[model samples]
Target: MAREVLAGRMGLREAVRVGAYADALADRVGAARHEYERQSPESRAGEEAEARRYLAGLRSEIDAERAPSRR
Candidate 1:
């Protein structure tokens, strides 16, 4: 995704920044999933739901940024 966003295009600085953001988000999602799995059964259900909601929001943000803008 970051590669697509940066494709053929960015200066070194911009590419680095984009890469950092992608890495951070990936780490966050991984940590969240791991934590969710480690929770008690009752808590796991709520945490899993929250993780899904957060992931959906992340997807929406990515899609919105990638979409072509209106003039």
Candidate 2:
């Protein structure tokens, strides 16, 4: 599909540079994955909090795309 090809190209570039806000959003999600994989918190509460934070970020990005931009 078109998405797969586009994603593949972005991955190849290492950092896709989706402007300022989107770049920060992508970094946050990547950091969350790293935290979970490395078990950085070592507690159920911390892990759950990280998960919630990441989900909230995803929701934010979705909302941003769906709404009109001021810029």
- Residue range 1-71, candidate 2, lDDT tens digits: 23534777555234444465457768889998886677644575776888999999999999989999897
- How high is the CA lDDT of each candidate model? 0.78, 0.70
- TM-score of candidate 1 to 2 decimals: 0.46
Model 1, 1-71: lDDT tens digits are 45645585555556546767668777989998898678899987887799999999999999999999988
- Among all windows of ten consecutive residues in candidate 2, which has the lowest summed lDDT? 9-18
Instruction: Give the C-alpha miss distance for residue 10 in model 2, angstroms.
Output: 24
What global local distance difference test value does model 1 have? 0.78
TM-score of each: 0.46, 0.39
Query: Highest TM-score: which candidate?
Result: 1
Per-candidate RMSD, Å = 8.4, 11.1
Name model 1 segments beyond 4 Å from true. Answer: 1-38
